[model samples]
Target chain A: MILEYKFEYLSNNNTLVNFLTNIADASDMKFEITKEKNEINFYVDADEEAMSSFASTIASDLPMSVFLQNTAVSLVQEMPPSNIQADKTKQFNLPFCPKCLQKAESAESSDYYNPFTTCPMCCDTKDIKEFIVSFGDEIKRTDAYKEVFEDLASRIHQGLGVRFKTLSGTFIFEKLENLQEDKNQKDIKLLCTNLANISNVVVAKKAEIVALACIEKPQMDFRINELYKSKNIIQAKRLSVRYPNDLILYLLSKELRALGIDFLSYKNEGSYDINVDFENFDAKESLKIPKLKILEQNRALVLESENYDKKFMQVFESLKEKNKAHFMVLLYENSLLQKRILNFYTSSRDDDNVSYYAKDLEGFLDVLNYRLPKSIQEVFEDIQKEESGERLLKNYKNKYPDSIKTALEFDLSVLKNASIVSFWKIAESILGFKNSILDNASLSLLEKGPRIDYKLFESARIYNKEFNYIKLIQSGMSFRLAGVDERTISLGYIESYAHFISNIADEVNKEMELEGISLSGDIFADERISHYVHKSIGKNFKIFYNKDFVIQTRF
Target chain B: MNILILGIGNILFQDEGIGAHFVHYMDEKYEYISQKNSVTIVDGGTLAQRLIPLIVRYDYLIVVDCIEAYDSEPGDVYFFDFENAPDEINWQGSAHEVEMLQTLNMIRMNGDLPPSRVLGVIPKRIDDDTAFELSEEIIAAADTMEQTVIKHLESLDVSLRERNPQITISAMAQISFKREIVNDSGI
Candidate 1:
């Protein structure tokens, strides 16, 4: 078997190069494989069933619940209306990587100025010229759009923030007309130079890449293997130890069940779901039977936060008046707590309505503008300088002797793994900005700051530190959103992770022009929403921030 | 007809550092080559991550590596498309999740990826058990890279108005990982 992408199955933007680039930059899916155009290929032990499932995912065109970065984008089948698509010349040569052209999500990301040109996206002189020429042709060809695009292109060429995207994975310029007071834009270079300042970078992609490479590949034994003695090999090596996928499913399912919620394990999709009745699944189809059962409802859906409880009661109560019992708000109250779980749910005053429950930090993160750290943040200087050894750990016995034993038990190897280091460092950084610090970087952590991070909770905005067993067992939709390798998470390297979700706001911004969407008012009323799904996992349609409650239910 | 320079080798195994060494060699010895922006020097390495950032955007990709050409003598010079390259010619190994071959496979799978050619120089020894110095044969191979580069430039009809006569034409093969003895104080 071989691992490869069938081109017809992938969106134009989801090219192999782009996918690999994203994985290299942002994810940790091991067992990399490749294929020529026509055949299904596998390397590093890809199974026939898994391969077929992947192929079907591409062919079926099912909506996926992909949690990328930290944002939750409800991808639907809608592309923003196009205004000036035939005029392609103006849009020809805009740079590809936002990390370089635009500011990184935070100042800690990395320095980009004078970077080596061999960087795949760093076009050579000719490529740049080719880009500009493409831009020019699009402009010259478009009799009407030319005037609009040219100004934007010029701004971009002169180094400014006029870059935007189209539904077809192309960039459109948004020219900032009338450069307030300075028509000549004298400080263009000076202003542009800030984007490249190394000193300004607090976290960098390059460092992360280097860190990823440091972990030694897991050891494997291959004695007297005819495969190794082969003349030539096209397949990648299989891991000696395969993590138990079934065991994980069982664990997660059992955990959720223990929480008075039964969950369904979709073996092929690599995701788990709650025991919601199947007859009420989605707008397209209703489930006739729920895979699992929930206890009786209308028992006072005890919510952790009063504000969340209030929001759900209001939205559903308003809809409840209309007799819209399609589904109740999706949360259930649980009395027994192994861990403090915050939940908010809206049910029909009667017992027949459906309810949604989002049971982790992600579900509860957006209440009252709960702030999160930028994708990458600088750790405190002290933590980086800590002497995390048995010797140093023992010296702290007087203050807290318990620390010595725990420190000794800590796995230095796991800690040394660069990716893990960066992960914990990121977590530490996020913890620092929990409305805690007053630095410029910390200020960016404000809910309305440039970056946004979402949490994926079990029911609502509660964190499950002790119920780690169940969360670990049921690798759900929000698993990838945590920006960790499935293997690592499975091995229990991390109980929580955050995906660097690309904000759907940009997609919204582009839809207006590309798809010709003209919503005058009532932002949600006329918006032609699009659905985006991950290629493999068919998880629930999870929206990170809505009424600030973490509730998962049939929509 | 872009001029491509590929530096290839396993940086971890001491002597396999030749590929990176050649790249640093060019970066140091031939400063003018890059200013032209006509030649792209890539550190192909054991894994292809370094080369990835520019893979999709280039027209030509030239890789320099220490080829364990089993059939050939030590320090032999050869170029072969990896897909059709001879077997018993171990261009890849199992020390990595992402190998040079897999990376190349990815590039091949990615339509519109750049055309590539690997220049594999014969290795005297890609390990440290041998002499602790650059082998004379490897040094000679490293010197030959200059000629190959010039041949490319000549083929492209790119005349270097200020060519450095002192640099020889050879691609060297050495092993070096990231942790080198080089100090930041520039001592």
Candidate 2:
């Protein structure tokens, strides 16, 4: 038997003939194929049994039944109905379009498809029973990704998204349970890829968003490649590749490299997308650091897709334990919600970790440049302000004056015979010149023994639990007094000492705002005054010179 | 030639102190070089500014330090002549109060810098640490660094004679070398 068939598509004919030849060779049959412009003819010389089997295989494998109407006269006269009719009638009992009563078209191929399957004239599918029935009871069975995947395709067509591939396709998707789970993925991936002429790219962070291809035309990929090459970016072509998910990651890696941040993917089984070690990071590479979660020893960042619906706060909560000392960086998402969440966390936890919902890649970079140093500087300033020990000593000095009066008097009596030069000198010497000798070390309570000489301040108020007289004397010594130590002890010095003691009483009263401890009313105040009394010969009355008399009465 | 081998670095920071380590190595291993030749080996420590006059007084100044390799691998040794290196290459980061390149440039501006060449190695670890230890990679490259300096000195027509090899290295060899006289008249 001899069989001949003509094919208008040379590619289809070549593929069909090649397949048939392999089959015929196994069956010990001979075949010839001849080609012309957009035409190819196949001739098969075979026995009846071989010819029958060959026709059966072609009928099943080639989808040739669709064109049976056109091939009826030239080839087989007794042709089966077009497979389009067979396929439609077997799948759905009702007509696809109730208005036009439209059936599956014979000439339609996968190349010819409609995202909107309803006839354009009707502009409504209310009358389509099969269309409505398919979605009626089984609407919940529709895969959630169908709409989003379609949106991604549209975004590519509108020049708003880049198409690339990753290890898990372009997206990181949770497995959805559905009747058509496998078929739906194939359809969506195919449709989105064909629509954009590039595989859809999965974007999780602001950096990846910046890496999105904004090219206006199909040829623009090459232009981007050229541009990247001129800029000495070695991964430009990989980043510009139309298909595959690694391109966006590759582009982001380059941008991070410029910022001295090494961008890496999850090496272990983990929820986060990227991890960066800040130890090797060059601070001078850029001014800001983006939203970063500093771990105990390392740092990481997680970027969610713009369509993410999971509770991001919950993820951050877990991250806090791992990064107690670090900041949490949320990508540009709901800004108001991010602020509310960050405010709550900071207030409740007493951690100033920031949640930066960057408006764009540039904004994210800016925060990183500014926040790192600012945070470090703030820590240093806090340390500087902790001079609590010094403040405590000053409080003691202001609260108790009578406690040191006796000691001050004793020191003066010893100095009375040395010399008489300046009154300020005697006053300073009576104050024990503690400010000149003690260092910052001497002021610290950690050192054993009294910081100041106990001979200078004799009252227990100086050594009381709330007041350490030693620290007071040491702190007093910390003050600067120039040329006072050089002057000899004189009446002028004694006068200054009395004046200094009275001034201390006035200053302490003003500072402490004591309710009842008046110089005249307090028991210790009278004793302190009487200690300074000295006999004097006077015409009218016996004149006693005390600290108050030396200071108030200028004789 | 009157030669000064200045080693600069922070001795407290592990690998960043490689320059000081190289000086100790040179002082002990090649003591004859300094004793025989007019070579002065100074432990510059982290103070590059204090060595400005020493840079001007020497006929030939050789600096040994650790370098930030930038794009290159760690332990990679590089030699740069002050008068003939690329401008960008001189911007290598330093662990000192002032970077080595900036110090050299200052002396250059003064118009009295001796012919200077920096022999440096990219350290494998410049991390935070207090130990004076070196990374294995840098320790392995130390001999090559010594040879590189020797070859540069040879090119400058300076010769070194061996000392009595029987004499053991001493603790005093670790000390920084300074001229006894500060007056320029002695030079």
Candidate 3:
């Protein structure tokens, strides 16, 4: 097995260099330093026994060192069983490991320390020597002779590993084989800057290259990663731990893919990892199944995660009114409260039209395999229930709250006694106008003292706000005429209000145009009628106002 | 050379009305400058579209307005060749109009838009007040801007000769005609 370790120390401090130097001077072990200023890498060659001992000593001692900031230790390649002349020379002696002796005596013990016997006690192993020398020959034994070794060597024998600093924080690992498999699970990959030294390429036989690749690409392939590198690794790690579920979502996507299930994975699609077709097992033929949409939601690890009720409701409401499916499958990890939430939502809805499957990955896969009912339509009797026109309009309004004009029309259509004032009030609410738009336009006309109400000249008009005074008067008169006789509401005021409304609407349209919002047909039609009415009623005000066509003032 | 002085700004915003006020001030005190057959002073007044034809027609155009071009003292005056002005010109248009840059670009798209110089003053206050009067800093900047505009006119070989007593105020006023008609049909 090949052993690789990366230990990072502050460049300003020479403690790491001094420590490695001291070890090399004290032993016959030859180590090469690939030093680039602050970073000093040690590449040592030794027999299996010596390497294991050295690895164990370093793994136990280095992690606690103030100067040893970070270290990656991996066994590059397993030494051929009998290649070492020293090991072959000692083959005749009993390979005595006191730890293996005690371990074999336990009920869990699979094997005792013997050259020929594979030790089940040390760890499930084919060879007794492989058990004692797993990490690095670091474990101490009460043998007659005192022999010291590094724990990292035995750990490497157990698995290929890496230790490195990432933007997210220190990524310490004991194994890195399934990384290539994990990378293939998602289309998105992390771009680790410092980890560039380790590439994603999987090479064979060359332990050095493999070790380097493992170090550089751990971020790309591991569950322990982040969206972007933090300037301070420590802070990033602390923050990352807070939202570990977000980190898990990235991993869960891979886990789901590993299950070999056919599902469409959508990135951040309404806070879910995937949308699986429960009824249709085949990708090509899944669309044929009329009702098979299942959103797979993954909850974060925190005690209180984002509420899915509102978000799920909004999503269910916006489903292209034509979509056949409406169901959610929530995947939770170690969350006991999630079951209660699922139950709460399931029982809260009046119709209970939505089917839900909530559980952890293992439980979810079990449900997917043995429990899920086929054809969601069979599960939901109200699948074909058509929404009323008013309900549809309400849903539309909910979806587009910024569309105030449409909402106003919807409100007016539903009102019991919709008067002109009510209509204007609706319009004002939609336009975000605080004061009555009609009143402001009309009162602005009274700015010039005691002017003839009909011939409201420019000097008499107030220009404080954007409104046409004449159209306001016309709208006011039209409102009065709805209830009062024309004998009371003079034609001049009516004409003035008509023009005012027309001018204000046109101005509003122009303003909306600048903002790149094309007004809907209903709003456009309302404004257009005002403009056309004013245009057709030209000069008729003179006949009505001069005679005082005397009517009572509604105000 | 037919020289046109176009002032542009939205009067709804207090100090933004500086351009409109400058044009009106020039119309009163420097109407004498119009004695030169080629000189025309226009109050563009929040209407970027209104200045398009005049911009393309004039041989030389000088624009006056409140500009937030650089981080400087509020009343600092800046005069520069409009063609060489920074692309990051801080001129926001009113809700009903295109920006000044867009209007100028439209003219250039049609053909050449005459040699132009933009005389700008950084305003101290641009509060959301629909008042006609300018702040004191703006008023002071306007005085300095007047001198700079005079210098620019001199460089263009145009001088503000004293008005002939014979030239009636109405005649001088006629040159200030608003191209866009106001629809006050009832009056």
Query: lDDT tens string, model 1, B47-149?
Result: 3533453566667766777666567776677766655776757754323223566667777886745667666776665422211245567677765765675
Q: Rate the local accuracy (lDDT) of all candidates.
A: 0.30, 0.35, 0.35
DockQ scores of the candidates? 0.01, 0.02, 0.03
Highest TM-score scorer: 1
Q: In model 2, which regions exceed 4 Å deviation?
A: A1-555, B32-37, B86-92, B95-98, B161-187
Clashes of 1: 97
Kindly list the per-residue Cα lDDT of model 1 for residues A389-423, writing each as its tens digit: 22222222333344333433434333322222223
Over A241-272, each residue of candidate 3 has an lDDT whose tens digit, in order, gives 11111111222222323332111111211221
Error of 3 at A339 (Å): 76
Where's the lowest-lDDT run of ten residues in candidate 3 chain B? B178-187
lDDT of 3 at A390: 33
Question: Comparing to the true complex, what docking class would candidate 2 get?
Answer: incorrect
Each candidate structure's TM-score, on Cα atoms with residue i matched to residue i, is 0.28, 0.25, 0.26
Model 2: per-residue Cα lDDT over B103-178, one tens digit each = 8889999888988888877776643323445677876677688778778767666554444333221221222121
| Candidate 3 structure, TM-score to reference | 0.26
Instruction: Report the CA-based lDDT of candidate 1 relative to the real structure.
Output: 0.30
